[model samples]
Target: MTPLGVFFLSIGLAVLLGTARGSMRRLVLGGGLSLGVAFFAFPFSRALGFLSRDALDPTLLALVPVFPWLALVPVLGGLVWLLALRPQWAAWSGILGGGGLALLGLLAQAQPTQLVRLVPLYGLMEGVTAVGVGLGVFLLRPFQRGWWSLVLAVGLGGLAFSWLNTQGHLYLPKMVGYYKLLLPAPPGAEEKLVAEYNASLPEKNAVLKELGQPLLRPIASLRDLEGGLPQEAAEAGYRLLQPSQLQYGALAIFALSGLMLGGGLVLLRRPSLWEMGDPKAALILTGVLSTLLPAFEATEFKLQKLAKGWPFLVQFVDKAWPPNLANPEAGIFPLQSVLSEMLLTVEIALVGTFLAAVCAVPTSFLAARNLTRGSAPMRVVFAIMRAFYNVDRGVDTLILALVFVAAVGLGPFAGVLAMAIHSLADLGKLYSEAIENADRGPIEALEATGAAGVNVLRWAILPQVLPLFVSYTLYRFEINFRVSVVLGLVGAGGIGYFIKGAMDAGHYDQMIIGVIAIVVVVNLIDFASSWLRSRMV
Candidate 1:
């Protein structure tokens, strides 16, 4: 009857399903039935005030009915319980339940003003589709059990989200029409009367307050409002104007979003490889189809028709361009400059690793029991070293960088010291493990040959532990490279500094290029380290 009651009843039924012998199948059916009803019915209930109540906190009340997808909490709670307590049901439940909640809440909030809110939902849908397509293509025996369940769970969830988004009525006054689909006005009816009703609403005052009076002025038509341009912009002396064509383009864009959204779902259900049951073809098809579908729905060409609509479509059209990578008249490659910054990052990592290795090896020997022996005095010494190692490691590299940066005033030196300190703790642990696992036979033989304590370690322990020590050092080196990049976030002089700078300037292309450079540099270091490890082995 009520939205809350309906949601609770659904949960009660789900619990009953969990008790059944074939629990997962029952859960699948029960969950679908409960969520399916609540998805559409809840919106209607909100409109009718079935769940409406006066608010204790007035500010929070504004966020409730306008965003009722909160019913998804129980669904998610059920899935998590199923995952941990009943692994068999986890695959389907986790994907489907998590996906449904995320999508339902997302689409319910999709007013013209809230379109940007769907970005993360779109991202989730993309992720779910990718995972489902991956599972369908790969038939690895070890992973098959978990993968199939995950795919089905995510698929069901995605479908629930898509269905709910399309079914709900737009909450913005009836005169504004739904955002995604434009309904035709009744024949011989005056559009002006509808516009007048829309102007009288509290929402118009709210919009004026948020957007400012000047921005809302000259909106004589729905086309003027949607397209964002006023007619006779020069004569009216308005700061911004949108052509009529752009308004239609905005409408087309929203319509295309719905189609693109639907096409992605259809692409997931179809099988591309019947012979081998390969899902790669299906996956590639989905990727190409979903990505390209929006391209055909271009709105930029309509910018010249500003009499009826907004110029927002021009923004999207500019995004479609490959980008003007040429220098801004300076004969300089901005990309190359960013790439050079990444080279400096590699330098910082290498230098820091070398310094850390030189310090960590001796400290590690102090922590190792083999070097100290089974004596109580030696154990106490080992304990102290271990305590010191953890303290050094426990504090994050960033804090260390901040501490050193404060002392030295922000540069690579602070970053290098931070990496060395963090590396000391990490390398100490690995070195101790290597010593613990070392062959005691060689150590015993040295003792039998009348070797002294230091001689035994030098002649027997060092030879056995050397390879392992090198491995740990190399691993720490890789970690150091990553740490150096992070350190650059605090002006430690690397690609991170450049990235932060680019982000601050709103230069996304430069930011992307910087990120690409960082990835390349890190990969190169990894490859070189692997080659070195091969030689060591």
Candidate 2:
């Protein structure tokens, strides 16, 4: 089916279902409003150059094959079974049909190759489905007390195990090799091993040289050449592994045992637990369990090594403190250069926030549902704008900076653009929410008079929301300032570039200076923004 067809059909189905659920008047009204909105959504989006005709074709074509297998088959089978045998099982039939359709719709967008890579996700889906099925069975036969609890518990345990196995965390082979290497070798083995190890260094260095790009070479060198147990073990013809290696199996066992114990406790306390009466509560419990189980199983929980590093931390502080208050040696990044770059970072945030605020003002109006009321075309436009905001905000500033760097090449310009784009989305959403939540009384009064749409917005809406917009813009500027420093690490040009270089060359003192500069600047901005926001509010 075409995208339009699919959309209308879905709406029709929703209307039908709503009618069946005894909400005919609401269903009809909502369906009409939805259709009206749909009528103008595509055209307006197209006129704005936001909608691409080519993109729609591929999406619709992908869904074509999915509809028959997922939608038609399940619905037909359900209809036949319901008519011929169990008339009372229509709800289950609808669930099966709807679930299949939803799954197909999700899968339609993913390439087969991508799907193959997501085999682990299939286990998660299956686990969730199994839980649902077990619950359904319980609901169908509630008289069989405690049966569903046991089923759900066992199913969840199996799911946890499956997820753990898929994550490769529970794989024993790698751990076994590391453990074997930790065992001591005999006297004769040492001399021979030393000869072999010396011979291997050139080969290892060659591999490192080949793999290490200039950008990553520092990290590679630190890992491969650093004076650590791993390095020592490698030279002695062995491997060194973290304490997690020994504790991993025990952690996994404990995690699974804990989950079972927790599940049992839930079952035993079902009557008192809120989930006993609420499916939503049960679902939330299941989700929480699923997440906690994997995290508990994978966590190292070993802190002895961390405790051992306290002395080194102190030594680092001793070397880096007082920050060379006098005329210090001008390294690659001189003090003057660091100070200038820090100023540039602040400038980037200021310019970016200003640009973002300018772009966001108009877009926020389009995105505010309250402002777009009674206008189907405008409501559709609101959704599109909201989606744009969501997508831009969802992408990280660092990732955006990288893209801008690729497009516009490295420097503060790239950082500025990246910050601006991210801040635009953030500020737009904030601005829209402010507009939506503004006093409707003022807007209604203006509209009731001879005020036009634009006049109503200008006179009534803008006055209420402008202060909030300014406050949010200031807050976003502070965030952008902090993020800009990190952007410079990726060659977007600021103090972070110097900091990254200091880190790469193991210049702890310089890194400390850079960090101190950031802290002072950020605190200043935070205080100023807070004070401004307080006054604005």
Candidate 3:
């Protein structure tokens, strides 16, 4: 689609969405944002050498082989829905629609040759695609109007765009893939060349058998034929066909995206649906689309490449399976192996959670609002402690692992430190909340008896919150173990480190072993932790 066409299309889509949702604000927001995106993103992207005019264009099949009568079902259904609901028109519309269908069926049966000819697949697909779009939009249950509006608008725009222009295909459900692949267009001369060769192959092979020569190989594609075919085959007008792979480039992605989006437009037209939601959602959605559409161009997000690339992924999966538990390089038999690495990973998680819990138990009392109240100095400490927790939590553990890996060198020690530092903040926050929620009656009763502050806390707050602290610690231990696995990927030691080494050396079998170990150990640890937490807490 041309930039100008996209620009207008965006605005129209936004407006339609607003109308469907019954929100004027949505209409304005969607239209304005869509126009802004189309105006700035699409054209400038083209000018900046990000996309060509046809960059978004998926190859549209000009004609499709859907028998034209099949298209009539939904069209008639829609017409009946639109016109037959009225008290005055219901009977007449039903009669006319049903009789018209019956007559069309009779005509097709009478003249099967001409009446059954291929119709424009685009027209059939337009309704079918729109219906697919509607199904996707139907995902809303407790339907929020704002998000629904955004979806319907985009779907309407896509279904409309398929008619006016051809930008690349968005895979939905082979709905558009059907257009990409099965349209009624005849094979090009290049394709016909291969077809001709294959058609003649049986005859040639039979002759070869009679002459006591080797039989010709069956041709699946142009590549199957030998260099320039035999000289006789070439002279017989059977030069190697152009690669058929080129035809698949447009249809590469699955058509799920198209089915959902187009289906939405059809649903909106037919369903007389309305709901309330934030209109700003439409504006937000449009802004995102503006950015993402351009990003798709910049990133060249074509799924078609997968057609040629899927073999590599399949090959990797095949090699990676049946995890190798034994490693001869580590040691013979069961002396040292993945078992050692797995044990180290558990130690890292165990040590990190232990350290964090030890520190947090004492420090969290100062951070709790109830404990720090009634003293200016304690309040200051509370603010400082809370700020520290927030700052520490904000810094991700993996990033901390990278820093520690550089400073401490690559080992489980680095992973231990990263997990401990991060877990301290997490445990501190949970512990403080538990402390703040402790019952006040015991502390007051103890304090009234002239007990020291420390004694009051020991007798009252500690007893109340200790079980919760243990529960929280067990939870943190579970999380820390998982984090440690990731830390190993960054050279902070454990099974992640072993896995990374195996992957880098293309020992997928060994790598899969590490992955399986991590999974099995994590599930076991989680189950054990949950049981202990339930029992102790």
lDDT of each: 0.53, 0.56, 0.59
Q: Per-residue lDDT tens digits of candidate 1, residues 1-537?
A: 322333344444433433442223323323333333333212111111011121011111122233444445445544443442333443444345534543443343343321001001123333444455545545333345876766665665566445434542243132121211112223432244335535565655677788776334434444344432222221222211111112222222222222222222222232120122212332343344334434543534433467444555465345424433547686856577786778788788888888877877777777887777778898899999999988988899899999999989877888888887888788888888787888989989889989998898788888988988887788788888888888888978788887787668766666667777778877887898899988994
**Sorted by TM-score, highest first, which candidate order results?**
2, 3, 1
Runs in model 3 with CA error above 4 Å? 1-44, 49-308, 327-336, 439-451
Q: Which stretches of candidate 1 lie over 4 Å from their true place?
A: 1-328
Q: Please tell me which model should have the higher TM-score, number 2 or number 3.
A: 2
Local error of candidate 3 at residue 116 (angstroms): 51
Best by TM-score: 2
lDDT of 2 by residue, 97-152 (tens): 33333343334323221000000122343444446655565556644568666666
lDDT of 3 by residue, 64-156 (tens): 132344345335534543453342343344344434433432332243111011222344455555555655555542357767766775676
Assess the local accuracy of residue 400 in candidate 2 as a C-alpha lDDT between 0 and 100.
Answer: 94
TM-score of each: 0.45, 0.51, 0.51
Enumerate residue pairs that collide in model 2: none
Instruction: Provide backbone clash counts, one per model.
Output: 18, 0, 30
